[model samples]
Target: MANAFERLVEKMDRATLDRMGKPVLINDVGFVAVESHLIPEMGPLTGDGISLVIFSSDYKPRRNDQTVWDGQSYIVTRYQSFNGKPQVWLE
Candidate 1:
């Protein structure tokens, strides 16, 4: 597969923070992404990937138990809730 910084111009289903602790949405805010970086996360796996983004403000995921990226499908691996504010998992 190829890798490049693609821009997402739409609201994503789930918004969370990346390895860099940045606010990253599936397809919101139109940020730059790498195919090699996110493509792997597009599948079904039983592990967690390191954070990539550096913005953590409005991260409210739907579920959490075991986030997996199997290359073709994805699954929730953990669950985290928010309180009407922006919160990121730093440190």
Candidate 2:
């Protein structure tokens, strides 16, 4: 079972997303609402990138998974969980 803090965080995350997120397409499965952050420059090879926090219950993303956001296509290059949320990096 999740601890109280974890449950609270989940609720807060959902509320924030519901109010602020935009639609994102993942692998053409369907459109999910998420808050995405754009990084102006990622690195030499990857170039610019987008980062978004997501709940595993909503969608679990893997590396190389295709995503479409703001009318641009990208690939999931990496991800790491922080504070019960997965920070997905798209390139």
Candidate 3:
């Protein structure tokens, strides 16, 4: 049977991975994950929008933990990795 990581990789298309997915350092670990171009605003200016989504084979972030991407820092607000690839949502 295919493992979770394998399933995730299989589901990812070459074009999407090549275009949108970029390698970034997560907790200093290198991973090819998806990052959103739109940056969420802080404070009262912040709107109802998801900040970032990370697609990785085997990386999970605890809620409220800080993560760095593209030289910027963000906090992980939600995540799920039961199906295939781990999907992390940043706030």
Candidate 4:
């Protein structure tokens, strides 16, 4: 199987992302292996089809729209002056 870093390198390419259609996140939460698939979101502002990742010690996913009221969604909470306010979504 491809390691998580390899997967990210391949998937994060702009060309790759554009062609792959929208990404759908399905979390079995606590499952042992990773299995990703594509799904169409019913509407906008619900979340996006593309997946954004934030990895730390492990490639723990916080798939699109998966955030709960605990409040760790993709929404940017802070701002920056000169450059992109968005943090490097990956650690």
The top-ranked prediction according to lDDT is: 2
Per-residue lDDT for 72 in model 2? 91
Q: What TM-score quantifies how close candidate 1 is to the native fold?
A: 0.23
TM-scores for the candidates: 0.23, 0.66, 0.57, 0.19
List candidate 1 stretches off by more than 4 Å.
1-54, 64-72, 80-91
Q: State candidate 3's TM-score.
A: 0.57
Lowest lDDT 10-residue stretch of candidate 1: 5-14
Comparison by TM-score, 1 against 2, better one: 2
Give the per-residue lDDT of model 1 (tens digit) for 3-91: 34222211231333222222234323323221123355588744544322322344344433122222222333333333333222211
**Tens-digit lDDT track for model 4 on 1-91?**
9999877765654444355433322232321111122355633433333223222223333324242222223332322221111112211
**Model 3, which residues run further than 4 Å from truth?**
1-11, 36-53, 81-83
Clashing pairs in 4: 23-49
lDDT of each: 0.31, 0.73, 0.63, 0.31
**Clash count list over all predictions:** 26, 0, 0, 1
Per-residue CA lDDT of model 3 for 1-91, tens digit only, reads 9999877766664556788877666676777776544444533534554444455656766787677766777777777663355666665
